[model samples]
Target: MSTRILISGASIAGPALAHWLGRYGFEVTVVELAPALRDGGQDVDFRGRTHLTVLERMGVLDELRALGTGGSPMTFVAADGRRMLHLPAEFAGGDVEVPRGELAQLLYRHSSARAEYVFGDSITALEETPSGVRVAFRYAAPREFDLVIGADGLHSNVRRLAFGPEERYVRHLGYYAATWRLPNDPGLPVGSVGLNVPGRLMSVGASHRDPGRAGAFALFASPELRYDRHDQAQQKALVRAAFAGLGWRVPQVLDSLDAAPELYFDSISRADVPAWSSGRIALVGDAACGATIGGMGTGTGVVAAYVLAGELARARGDHRAAFEGYERLLRGYAQGCQKGGDRTGPFLAPRTATGLRFRNAVLNRRWALDKMLELGKEVSSVELPHYEAELSGMAGREG
Candidate 1:
């Protein structure tokens, strides 16, 4: 009998996992909390061969390349709007860059035919039985599946229910980041333009699709503030307080906050779960290992999904063996990738003025900038197994 798998969160990781599970002939169902597929998030990039290979295997590489953002070059300016430093588009865009929303939509479209997706709902509880997992939803009737996986994200409900409270695994990385859209006003350039004042970075860039619309990206150093994630007004207020006295279009960006339709705000945090799975429930992607901004999280999540689903198929539905192999193969690579996230916030907005200046001075040099880019490529490197061979062999035997 085909293994019935229930996955939480229909974002990148969830749908990616569903695609592989369905290919392997497993019954897959994905539940997402959002009413619909989210739209308009920060541009995410896939760097190095490892990331590209996975996308190629999934048959989305060509499409993603076509949709890629040409690049988002950044120019850091002084208070008076004089450019102080510049970083090329390749520095941030990597090999392939696409708005997160577009990628999510693509993944959803790819997996929808095979995987049952329940949007506008979420898993409220999980109960593991000897044979399977019983899941309770916020709206839908309860159901049972052979296994459950959490691809939800950093603050995953599955992780919270299966493992423990969020605090036990989620670590605040001393910063907060927020993004929103505003009118591109004639002043903002085509690419990113920003001003940094010790501990805070406020920037605005033209939206890749719509030239008339601009996007705001900001980060500020903070120990960890208490706020409701659902409260957009409160989050905007916090952002305002952080950049209160800033200059160079910051006031205008702040003014747009009230009128902005949506905002993405959260503490720059990382999750380090000791074990990726317990019993019939498991965690993948951000729920297991995630870094908020700096972490090559998007690529890592996609890679992890492939491995987890492939391992499950290899194990022939023996979840104990599948889960163990998945962790053994991926734990090291995921952790190494997560290390980059630790430096993301500090690199974007240094906590001290001297630190900020040093970053700009060093990155201003071509050699230093090249070295940093090279290091990023190196971090993304991972040895992936050809799971297709194993699955094909299994099919041959069955035939």
Candidate 2:
């Protein structure tokens, strides 16, 4: 029988991994906590040759290229509406940027026909037996799988269950970020215009496709605070408290939250797991090694999915060798990519006004912007082993 693989989380990593695993002849199943495919997330991007290569191999490169939202420009302004710093769309838009939601859908489409996808459900327990791993779900009958992978995000349930508590793996970097939708204020200009106060940033941009609605992305420096991840009211209260008494349309944006159905609020954080696997269960993407935001996570996750699936296919039934090879190949590159998350908080919402000014001043120069972009590429670089031969073998059998 073909290897049966169950992957948790239906976001970027899980779906992408499903595509590769299906291509390599694995019986794949994916479970997502969300009832439906999530939509309306911030634009995520992939950088450098390494990211592009994996995308091309997955055969979704052209589709993503077509869906690309060009590097959306962002302007930082004073409370009085004077532009302090203007960053070109390309500056933040890596090589290819698309709405995170759209990318997730595209991947799901590619693998849905071949893989069993259970929405609004999640894994509750895992037990490895001599035959396979016994798995229990929140609302489904228990089943056994040959292997399990956690592609969930930073707060991975599988990681917590398999590895340990989240405290041992995730490190908060003195900042919190929140984003939500609001009615587009015709009085204000379009595109992202942010107000940068000491330790706080509030930005809003109207959707290019839907001028009637806009999205607000906020960042603020803060020490770690305890909060329930699943409680929206508490999360909204935390955001309201964090950005209380802000000027320049912040109140209006916050007011809109009353009607907002969903909000993404979390501390900026990174995850570091000493190992990526435990017996029959393993981890991929952010669950294994992630730097929350601005850490090339989208690209790194895609690369890791490709490598992990390829390694497993190459190893046949020997999951131990496959898991080892996968971790060995990705750990250094993933850590290199993660370092960017450390700087993201300080860069976005500097603790002091002076720090904010310095960031603006340094980035204002053309050379400096170019240098930083170049450095971003270096961090994303990794040598990918050619798996085309393995793919060719699969095709030969089909022919």
Candidate 3:
């Protein structure tokens, strides 16, 4: 019988894993807490050969490329709205950048026919049995699967249930980030424009497809604070408090916060899991090794999902071997990519005036900017095995 695999989270990683696992003849089920596919998120990019290779294997690279956001050039402005520093589009937008929402939807469309997706529900408990895993859900009937995998984000429900509390693995990087959509007033430029003060950054950029809309991406350095993730008002208050007296279109950005339909707010954090698996349960993507932002997290998650699903196929459903192989092959590469996130907050919004000036001065130099870009390419480089070829060979044997 084909292996029955349950994957938690329907974001990039979960759906990508499902696509491969289903292709390998595994019965896949994806569970997500969100009622539906999340729409409208910050643009994510894929750089280097490793990321491109995986997308090519999945057959979604071309589609994504067509939908790519050409790039997002950023202009840092002074309080009076004069350009202080300008960064080319390529600086933030790598080889190919696409809205995260579009990517997630594409993966879902590819896998939905073969994979059973349970939305508006989540895994509440997971019990390991000799033959399989007994699972409990928030809404669905209890069921059993050969294995369970957490493709959930940094604050993964599966991880909390199978591993432990979030505090154990998540480390805040002394900053907070928030993004929301607003009307793209004529005053806002085509690309992003921002005001950066010591420890704070307030930016707004036009939508690639819709000139009528804009996105606000801001960051501020701060110690970890206690707040409800679901409390929109509270999150807005925190943002307001952080940038209380900022100037240069920041007031306008803050004004839109109350009316913004959706808000994505979270601490700039990283997950460091000692082990990616235990017994019948395992983790992939951000749930395993992830940085909240600037960590090449989206690319790493895609690569990790591909590796994990491929290892399972290669192992022929022997999860113990598959899980170990997945972790062994990806642990080092994933951690290496995560190191970039450690510096994201400081690099984007330095804590002191001197630090901020130094960062801008250094980054403004052509050589220094080139070096940083080169480093990004180096960080994204990873060796990927040809899993599709192996899967095809196994199919041939079965045929």
Best by lDDT: 1
TM-score of every candidate relative to the true structure: 0.97, 0.96, 0.97
| Alpha-carbon shift of residue 367 in model 1 (angstroms) | 2.3
lDDT of 1 at 202: 93
**lDDT tens digits by residue: candidate 1, 95-137:** 8999999999999988888999998999999998877899999
Worst 10 residues of 3 by lDDT: 373-382
Query: What's the true lDDT of residue 24 in model 3?
Result: 81
What is the Å distance of residue 108 in model 3 from its true position? 0.8
Query: Which regions of candidate 3 deviate over 4 angstroms?
Result: 394-399
List the candidate 2 regions with Cα displacement exceeding 4 Å: 187-190, 391-399
Stretches off by above 4 angstroms in model 1 are none
Q: Report clashes for each candidate as comma-separated counts.
A: 0, 1, 0
Query: What's the candidate order when arranged by decreasing TM-score?
Result: 1, 3, 2
Q: How close to the true structure is residue 139 of candidate 2, measured as C-alpha lDDT?
A: 97
Specify the poorest-scoring 10-residue window by lDDT in model 1. Answer: 373-382
Q: Candidate 3's residue-wise lDDT over 1-399, tens digit each?
A: 329999999999999999989888899999999899998779999988888999998999899999999888888877898776788888878889999889999999999988999999988889999899999998889999999999999999889999999999999999999999999985466668889888888999888888899999989999899999879899999999999988888999999998898899999999999999999899999999989998889999899989998898888888889999999888988898899899999988889989877887888899998897776667546688898787788789999
lDDT of 2 by residue, 1-399 (tens): 339999999999999999988887899999999999988668899888899999998999999999987777899988887888988887788889888888999999999988999999999998889978999999999999999999999999999988999999999989999988888865455568898999999999987657888888989888899989989899999889988987887888889888887888888899999999999899999888888778888888999999999898877757999999999999999998999889988887789989988999999998998898777656557788777686677769989
